[model samples]
Target: MSAAGQTTVPFTVPSFAGEVSDAVVKVLDSGWVTTGPQTAAFEQDFADFLGAAHVVAVASCTTALELCLRAMDLPPGSAVLTPSLTFCGAINAILHAGHRPVLVDIDEDTLVPSPETVAAAAARTRPAAMVVQNQGGYPVDVAALTEAAGLDRTRVVEDAAHGPGAARDGAPVGSSSYAACFSFYATKNMPIGEGGAVATSDPDFADRVRAMRLHGMSKDSWKRYLPGGSWRYDVKSIGLKANMTDIQASIGRAQLAALPGWQRTRGELVARYDAALADLPGLVLPQRDLAGVQHAWHLYQVRVPDRDALIAELEAAGVATSVHFIPASHMTSYRAVLGEEECGRVPVTDRVAEELLSLPLYPGLSPDGQDRVVTALTGALRARS
Candidate 1:
């Protein structure tokens, strides 16, 4: 129902405005707003939701990745295998953890690193760990990837930043991995303005993450302030300041509660998009969900010829769009580490990067807005042809 002059449709918008506002105000009134009871409650609730044994809330997914890597205690300069076609945070975490990142190419169809690719990379680099990412909320085959990488679950970390509600082979993403990291950024599946968590089944690993998240203190501030609590504590080891505040946790809890319904809405929107755009020319849709797996539908990306032109056309028609990622190898910082020749190894990643386009798909997007997007996109493709 929209026309070229109609109001613009945003790429994404956080849901439950009223609930988030109320949660924030309640936390403001509680006085104890730092990483306190609310954060603990959120951590427990999130762990329960993911069917994980333990969850440690942090300030961001990047920090959660760093925490997970640090917990592993890998040797400095050890190689960590990761996909080049993913968010920069994944690679940044590897570099920041004092490890050398071994970039791998993605499968053309699934847009994720394949088991074969991982195995090949592992064979070449003898990577100490494999950071598997669930790009765009599509759950990767973790078991197969781990087997191919010749690494046990203990050496594999799931970058589930886009995969909070996703499942693989009838198990939730966090449940199947040794450790899974999630994000609650403003635009993530669960919007908390800024927060993340590390979920793990190992109690010892969980304890280490908990300690490392808060200055490596013997006890966190919440525990130290309790009745009969000791006034003194020991700094067990050097740690990062990545604790999640109660305010963010409160918002995260509210968002978590509303997530199921929002996810349903997202699924419905994706179905609509598939139906509307299936036959469009010079376009490649995202892969369909495999049997027994649930996609979180965080991003509705497609491969199209003249991707930039389509984006410009959509913008002129008042529809907002985005790009999910630019390959890590394409970045200047990574280019210095991975020489141009090495970066060119990911042919699929480079090709996909040039053609990928993220359309507007969110809980609040209306059917009419989607129709307008489809119309604009089809028009642009036809015009080019």
Candidate 2:
């Protein structure tokens, strides 16, 4: 509620307290503010959290995906499989990495590509690499998908931007994938305002990414400036200016520490949404429970018959909503770059694009605010009915 007597609900909110501010302040005060102790500590802490072997922080998830793809050293113009019902950035990264995007269809239930879809795409293109994303924090079984893919284990990169600490069958996300890329963006599970990281199993691959993230240089600013350290470093290979700064990593460390509690809160809120909307006619809720799978709960999306009308009604009532993504096929660049035939068959992705609506969900969203969202939702549904 505000002074104008309007009740409001934001689509998402970042949870940042004094610890985040203090962490940034401490980083700014330190003479070494660029990739240094704080950034290194955050990478180690994240690796420990996911039980991953080697972790390297980067500027964003897009570049993380690009770097991981480039690390595979796929032959030029080789196809890279990814979900069509995903953020266009994933497809763009594949293109930017000098690979062709062979968009695959997603399962309607999970909103993530199924093993069947992976198998089908694999047979179609015999891709050199694939990006298996945990869309909306719903885990995609990498092992099953890889087996179905019939590709080498190292060819797959898990887009874990939504599910960094999320687990499946007792193993956390980064544990199983060849390479899992994580995001610490403003609205992500572990909010760092802006940054990302890649966790891989192979030490050699990790070393490649570490050097590649900083212009393929042998030594970073931290290593070069250490006492008796040489400023004379060698350039190893081609890389990107995609290094995560200490300031962002400092905030990310705080968010990572509070991750478990925040995740529980997200699950609780989703439960409330599930219970409240269960009886509402013509409303299709997201798949919430799967045995041995713990969701990241980054999104609480529902499929309504008239998405646009409901969005309007909610907006008028001071409630906000969002669409997870527009299908890649619908995007201008994807169509121009891949053509219709190259994008491949995607009936489910095309259909779901029109119906999906994401509601307000975040650790900072209060119970009363949730209730307000529900009330506004019910009223809108009733009117549409």
Candidate 3:
């Protein structure tokens, strides 16, 4: 339990100190800050890090997701199966790209859409694609989900917003299957202030994403500066402005350097939290499947009976908390498409939405700070009984 009335502790903010500043300094010194050399290098380096065939850096994860959907060129009204337990960006992307997002349920323990639910949804909708999220950094069983959807017709797009160094069965998150999106958002495992990337094994898909990320211009800004580079360029396709800048890429490059050490520290913290909160009644600990994958530990989310009450209690004790989602179908915009009664049919998502709460867990979090969170949560849940 949190020690009596201790409300203040060391404030831990996500940082970009180490090599981040130095890298950014280089970008500043270079003068040309827009999508240029650093951005190209970052894309190549990120691809290498994930062992992916190609990687495209973009302004944000939303852009990455949107661009992927747009590049795929799905038919109007085509259903794209996605988890209800994800950020709205993926859902919005599906909608913006001329498809309907068929929201699905997530497994209670994993917080990711289960193979069973995905199979059921696919069977019903025969979706154009399945946008599976590595919910809260816990790698979804890609093989299982892929198998569930069956080979032909439906493609899988991994929304790995919380995954950068994440893995499944010893393979990096973006390397395993279809197009995988990674966020280098301010709060992600690797901070790029606000940016993202999409990696894939498919060469054609990668090319399409690359083209779309920069107004569908066949040649990028870098290529235009080459020795024999032509001045005139054609608009290959009507595309959006979603390219990543050299400045952001410089930050991403630096963060990539520090990623391994930070991931190791995250593992240690998860272990400590797991041990500290182990036998608390009514508190469902976040589950981990260490069989093949290495968790990125983006946000340590758990289920509790009175989650809102628990969050209040923890906040009063000086702990910050967040909820991963509030089912997209339940939101006003989506609700118009999927009414209350229809949305409630996704039983697992509907029920778990009330129970899910994310605890404070990040690289900067100190052992003492973590202890405080554990004590606060355990005591809060215990008090209810």
My TM-score estimates for the predictions, one after another, are 0.97, 0.97, 0.94
Give lDDT tens digits, candidate 2, residues 1-385: 4334686788888887558888888888887789999999999999999988889999999999999998888999988889888887788889988999888888888898888888888887778888998988887889888788788889999999898657899899997567999988898988888899999888889999999999999999899998999999998788999999998889888888898888889989999998899988779999857998888888887899888988888888878889988989888878988887865488888888899999999999999989989998998787767
- In model 1, pairs of residues that clash are none
Clashes of 2: 0
lDDT of 3 by residue, 1-385 (tens): 3344665443235657578878888889988889989998999988888998889899889888888878777777788888877788888988888888877777787888888888877787777777889888888887788778773422778888998778887898987556888898888888878999999888888888888888899888778987899877778777888999999999888888888888888898889988998898887888786688778899888889888877777777878788988888678888887677656658888898899888877788888888888888888888878
- Model 1 shows how many backbone clashes? 0
Q: What is the per-residue lDDT of model 1 for residues 176-245, given as tens digits with 9 covering 90 to 100? A: 4688999998888888878899999999999999999998888998898989887799998778999999
State each model's CA lDDT, in order: 0.89, 0.87, 0.82
- List the lowest-lDDT window of 10 residues for candidate 3: 2-11
In candidate 2, residue 108 scores what lDDT?
A: 89
Poorly placed runs, candidate 2 (over 4 Å): 1-5
What does candidate 1 score on TM?
A: 0.97
Comparing 1 and 3 by lDDT, which wins?
A: 1
